[model samples]
Target: MISAGIDIGSITSKVVILDDGRIYGSKIGFTGYNAERAGSSIYNSLIEELGIKHENVNSIVATGYGRNSVQFADKTYTEILCHAAGAFYNNSDIRTIIDIGGQDSKVISLSADGNVKDFCMNDKCAAGTGRFLEVIARALEIDLENFARLSLQSGKPASISTTCTVFAESEVISLIAKGESRENIIAGIHDSVASRLSSMVYRVGLNPPVMMTGGVAKNSGLVKAIENRLGTGVLVPESAQINGALGAALLAAKQNYRQ
Candidate 1:
């Protein structure tokens, strides 16, 4: 059976195709301002690229912030459940998940069987999220892609005490005015983000064998900061950015088999 999963996040959309329980193909694209269009466009593009006919897809599951916007989805699942399933699928030993997306951050504790035991989300603000980093990057006049490399070069990360994104940006600007090294400032930003996220992780009761699944998982500097803050190593899967889509596709296949 062929099944598809679409995850329409705030900043990007992803689609994953599964052929009889194995990954067939995946695609990612900017979500822009239209969630529904982004979801359909990415899914259709992936299907076409794989030379698969629409009718041949047995099931489709949608997930993420715009899960309900995918009209073609056979069903929708919450990001929490999808992230947990995706992490477990990647590494069964994973007992905790830290997903830092474009607009929000979440910490999920998984049961021994890969079920979500508890979760904590910071959806009310942009602080400690990818967007927050974007703001800081802009203030630093540095490309977001270079953040990790620069952060690693810092001898001593500057201190950023603000938890608010706006204030953080101002603080970064002030540091720049004070002739602070870009690398130090960037490292400090990573530490600030890690500090905020670690609080949520602690609140949800941290467990060992943690996995981080989200677009920000690609940020090696932030990952290192989080690892240092938690005093443990964190795993990042190759499909970290598309873990939610993979989970949705897996769910689609399972549901189709049951039916």
Candidate 2:
């Protein structure tokens, strides 16, 4: 059976198509101002790219911040559950998941069977999130794509003691005025984010075989910082950004089977 999953995140929308349990392909695009339209657009684009008719999809699931906006989905699931399922599908050995998206960051602990045992989410603020990094990158006049690489070149990361994004931006400006190296300032920004996320990781209790899933997982500097703070390696899947959609697709397949 062919099933699909749509994940409508704050900054982007992703659609993944599965033929039975195997992936057909996935598509991603900016969410834009119309969330519902974004969901349908991505799904339609994916199906078209796969050369599959809409009728061929047996089931559909929606997930992420805009899950409910997907009226076409057969059902919707929370990102926490979807992320756990996706992480397990990628690596069954993974017992912990750290997902940092556009606006929020979460740490999830999974049971032996890949079920979510507990989760801690920071949704109230933009600090320690992708948005925070975006702001910092803009303030530093650096492209977001080059931010991580530049950070890695630093010999001494400047100290950024604040967790608040606004204050952090101001701090970065002050650092620039003080003639700090761009590399050092960028590294310090990553370090601050890691410090905040590591606290959540510890709060949820460290489980071995951790996997990070989300758009921010692509940031090598942040990954390194987190690994250093946790003193453990973190696995990042190739489709890290769409893990939630992938999980939703897997769950949709199961749901179809149950019926």
lDDT, candidate 2, 70-114, per-residue tens = 988999999998999999999999999999999999999999999
What lDDT is obtained when candidate 2 is compared to the true structure? 0.93
Query: Could you tell me the lDDT of residue 245 within candidate 2?
Result: 96
The clash count for each model shown is 0, 0
List where candidate 2 sits over 4 angstroms from the true fold: 257-259
Clashing pairs in model 1? Answer: none
lDDT at 231, model 2: 96
- Weakest 10 consecutive residues, lDDT, candidate 1? 250-259
Please give the distance, in angstroms, between residue 224's alpha carbon in candidate 1 and its true position after superposition: 0.4
Error of 2 at 120 (Å): 0.4
Worst 10 residues of 2 by lDDT: 250-259
lDDT string for model 1 (201-250, tens) is 99998899999999999999999999999999999999999999999998
